[model samples]
Target: MSTLYLLHKPYRMLSQFTDKQGRATLADVITVPDVYAAGRLDYDSEGLLLLSDDGELIHRISHPRHKQPKTYWVQVEGDISEAALKSLRQGITLKDGPTQPAKARQIAPPASAPRQPPIDPKRHPSTSWLELTISEGRNRQVRRMTAHVGFPTLRLIRTAIGPWQLDGLAPGEWRTETLHAPRPTDKHPNRRKAPRKDQRARPAAKHRKP
Candidate 1:
């Protein structure tokens, strides 16, 4: 059986479990043995991060080819123009290549906890909130894409990944969920295979920081 954990990652913390430089990381908060992050979130970004001891689940969640949707609540430095919003929805070209079309729209600010060190309005332009969802996972893709459309992202917080959501977990807090078997997806061609008894879920220990 695998243990799945949802972590509400805080801003400025590394996605990795360890850091030789001694910056905060999963190890600093989570004591779970053998669990690993399913994807990478930038140190500057915050929000939902999934962890699992099952390698297969990890692959399904992290692989861009699987096309799992990732949703973010972004605060950008400007009153985003309709043109920019349209550009984001239509897919903008980046240094890497043309990104896949994304679901994006202006939104009211989310009710999230105040960041430890608040974002400085002086250094940033007047900002607006946006809900952006992408099916591809790329290095700093949200930040890069927003910048490309002339509305630089001042803060990025992922709200959900695939079928899972943050579900109100506070910063540095974590909760566990169980997956009885791998849910069938387009990537799984052999859907007829029976799930192994060992693949069942179990209650996982909670890990949170004060």
Candidate 2:
């Protein structure tokens, strides 16, 4: 059986287990071994992060092609207009590539606990909060998407990832959950089948020229 951990990562903590500068990491909080993060959360962002001991489970959870929804509570620098929300839903093009169409909507203020250091006050006397849910997990994606639409995000907190949520978990805390075997219909057709358990654990190394 595989082990799945749902971690509520606090702001300013590295996602990986190790940091050369002695910053906080999962290793500092989680005592489990051989578990790896399914996806990444930026050091400045706070919220749910999933980890698992099974490599196949990791890929299934975080791979963009799987189309798992990730919901973020974003506080932006200016009042978000209806046009901005529409643009986000239609999908804003980023420098790297066009984002997949997303579900963007203004939300009532969330009931999350206060951050240790609150978001900075807007210099221009404008700010708003909105909820954004996207299936793709691009690097700093929620921040970039909002900025592209002229409402730069001031603070970002991920509220959920797929079926997992940050409901009872507090900042910097973690809990484990049992994941059921994927049903035949639940698996993504595009994803290649994972190697059998008896196969070599390591993926084939790619050759790079010096």
- lDDT scores in order: 0.81, 0.77
Clashes of 2: 0
lDDT of 1: 0.81
TM-score of candidate 1 versus the correct structure, residues matched by position: 0.87
Model 1 regions more than 4 Å off: 184-210
Ten-residue region with minimum lDDT total, candidate 2:
201-210
TM-score of 2: 0.83
lDDT (10s digit) by residue, model 2, range 1-210: 566788888888888877769887766666665667877799889889887667677777766667789999998887899999999989878999998888888887788778777765556476788989998877888999999999998878888887788886788778877767751133654554453332212232441111
Q: Best by lDDT, which number?
A: 1
Candidate 2 vs. truth: CA RMSD?
Answer: 8.0
TM-score per candidate:
0.87, 0.83
